[model samples]
Target chain A: MDLVFAYLDPGSGSIIIQAVIAGIVALPILFRNRISAVVRTLRGGRAATPPPPSAPPTDDRPR
Target chain B: MSAPRPGQGLVREPGSWRDPAGFVYRRDGAIHRQIAPVFAAEWEAYLASGLHDRLVTRGAVLPFEDAPIADALDPATAWRVIRPEMLPVISWPWEWCPGQLRDAALLTLDLALEALDAGFTLRDATPYNVQLRGTRPVHLDALSFERRAPDAPWGPYRQFCRTFLAPLALMTERDPRLGLLLRSFLEGIPLDLAVRLLPRRTLLRLGLATHLHLHARAIGRNADGKGAEARAVRLSETRLRALLGNLRGTVAGLRWEPEGTEWADYADRTSYSDAATAAKERIVRGMAEAVAPTVAWDLGANTGRYSAIVAETGAHVVAWDIDPGAVERHHRALMASGRERITPLLLDLTDPSPALGWGLTERASFLERANAELILALALVHHLAIGRGVPVEMIATFLAGLAPNLVIEWLPHEDPMVRRLLAGRHDMAGGIRGNVAGWPLFREEAFRGIFADAGWEIVERAPIEGSGRVLYRMRRSGRA
Candidate 1:
């Protein structure tokens, strides 16, 4: 974070816009699992099965 | 005494780390002092005495008054109030001209003498505490003095040497312009550096030996142990007075006359006819009148020719130039004319003052403090744009950040001065491309594009005949 702020020139608005985009993309990914766990715990763990992932994961296994 | 009024918005100035005992704040455009409750009794007694009035009247210290304590109550740690006489501009020692630094040093010694006589001793002795009020020096930190240290051998001796003596010695012995070292070592020139920088001949001088040479050795030896031997050398009041007198004599003996520079003789070499000069002055006066700035900065102000015109608009003008000789000439002109509002300082815009001191909070960075109402960058952009290889957009952005209003002069490469700078430079392919090619490659459109990028709007532009110099009036989008 310190590096980001230091490197971002105050006069350049593009750096700020890039930072906002990065933040948006990373925010939900960082908290999605923890948030779901908290929601389950708060509901007394009634939903024992896990929910599906937000997006399907692609696989490329070596034969 | 009661607690301060709520919502008075008297936030402590964040830049008082050098002073640990008290802090300064601004409320309703008036400066206020807040003494730490630990030293309340001493502060009260000091104020009650006539010493405060004496110091203020003699122009040694900033004047202040006891403010009415607010009714909101917190008996413990209640802060004292003082409305100090505001300084028009606060300049650090690093930014000070050699004469100003010398004056501040003398003023500090004089204040120390007076404080001792008043049964007090100066606890802090940093050049940052002193500021130029007109040509004279005045102490800005009133809380630096405390009750007399009857036994202490000038408790602030090390600080005094670091801040004043070392820099003065280096400036006098090596080069008058070596004072710029203060900008690098903000806590005062490092004693170790000074010891190395001083000439071998300096060892012969008793003052240099006792003050700087021995002082640095003492600091190194006593880095861990108790400083008993150093403290053993005590001065009687008479001896201390003599020491101060000696310091004054030493400083008085040291002098630097800005001798030779290319543009120092610009007034003589100018091709401008008398009528042309008058016309330029008229345009400058018109711009100043239009802006009516309270604080103006004139960049590249050669001998303060246009700076004087800006000051004529009743603004406090800070004239800055890269050439010390030019600044010196401007200062002499001000002295001769008895002009109080104009202050000439030496500064190189390509490399301005940076954040310095402990945690970079002691003295304000140049850009942090350079918030002038009007900035006059006359005949300056060409040097930055062509000579030093700075982009025109970057220059515009920097200027826009400094002031709300700008009076810039665009000098075309066709001008003889520009031709002189372009001489003897490699014409590599990558080096000179696009508008960078040919002197005066940038047209008004380029200037407008850069200014617009920095959120500025051009109000007017007047081109001078046969000179290829155009004066512009621009305002920041927000306000004057």
Candidate 2:
């Protein structure tokens, strides 16, 4: 979990950016997945969108 | 790599060392993989997870069967062994056309996305992890996946960008040939270097700017080894999925339509008359039928007009051409038709893809994979002979090593097509000297003499009437 030793580089800049990026966009993605999951429950069947893992990932647009 | 492991017969593949989880070897002509003892738990988990079967069914991962540890290089170090279905030919990402590489990138992201849902994470995202199954991409490394650590950052995030997105974007915005940059930077073109070479307009695209230009700056600022400042970065599973979604959209949106290349439309333009074309087809078909090869190579296979004929004999064809646009156009059509027999590639014979990576052997050269049973070299010799002036003896010997049977066409310098190319040449021998005096005379006798010197004997000869074109069926003199 820590960048004590990254398999690729010592700088760990790559890891830091990912964390910052995730922090910036986390809330919107949480809401979207929640809404999609609710929609699947309402349809009264397995998710036609995602989380089933048999089909493709749901499309996501940039914020 | 001859560090000499414990096993007496295991010949380790050069490219298998980068990943510590497993190493692949060849035993009795079939590829065998031995998982390291350290990853035993993960290997067992993977088998029981049903994800292997799921991915295999989706045509994402190459199918494999369990094998005994007794056959491994060292049972002490081995935890599991699997024999994956053999690839007809092992080709690298550098030799692939743009369409092929894009498909590979998409496959990588798709697998990573699906793995997350299944409580697994892809460890790395290098293009080398994927190989072409005909025109399609299949993930070959079984160890790239591991059980997810809750709230952990995607470890290969930068790797995915450096190896796949940067190369694809450079080709899309600049020139398709820029994809060959991957050949030199085997670990994927460095993002900083790519940002410099890429056109400024790339920054105008939000995804490209953030993912490439901005990503490069991030890495640049941390170029100083600040191990003290390095800290654990947590990204929630939802955030990781969001990052993956952004990547998927960016990659899916980037488009490169192959167009306006010299040979992309050469198939529709002037080269041969109707009857000459038909005669050439007859010769190629008869030779293909006679050999009934399991695999064939069509050198200078522009747009695959003749490659389609060779594939009719049920042989998998590797259609090669120098023009990226032509190879791109050829592959797009194969994808559309769902024909898994013809694999089109961008290649230049004068300067072919060479053995590269650790010890210059990790990735195999183009000629190393040229183990095809038949070779169809139609309308290509002139370019090498007169246009490029490569010595005939050199060309003949190289062709001899590729395949046993050959369906080749020799063109004299007097033909209209040859004349046009000749008009562009001034002092002969590609303007290096005032001609070496018939050093490259494309005469019929010279053509026959060269291949003869290369230990090939002519089986049958047919000359297209009054076209200055001759077709021959030749075989290695003593191969039978």
- Which has the greatest lDDT? 2
DockQ of each: 0.00, 0.28
- lDDT digits (tens) for residues B379-449 of candidate 2: 88877876787777888888898899898888776678877767777755365334433544465787788
Each candidate's interface RMSD: 29.3, 3.7
Clash tally, candidates in order: 0, 0
Q: In candidate 1, what are the lDDT values of residues B67-94, reduced to their tens digit?
A: 7655112224447766788766767676
Q: Residue B444 CA error for candidate 2 (Å)?
A: 1.2
Kindly state the fnat score of candidate 1. 0.00
The prediction achieving the highest DockQ against the true structure is 2
What residue pairs are clashing in model 1? none
**Highest TM-score scorer:** 2
Query: Which docking band does candidate 1 fall into?
Result: incorrect
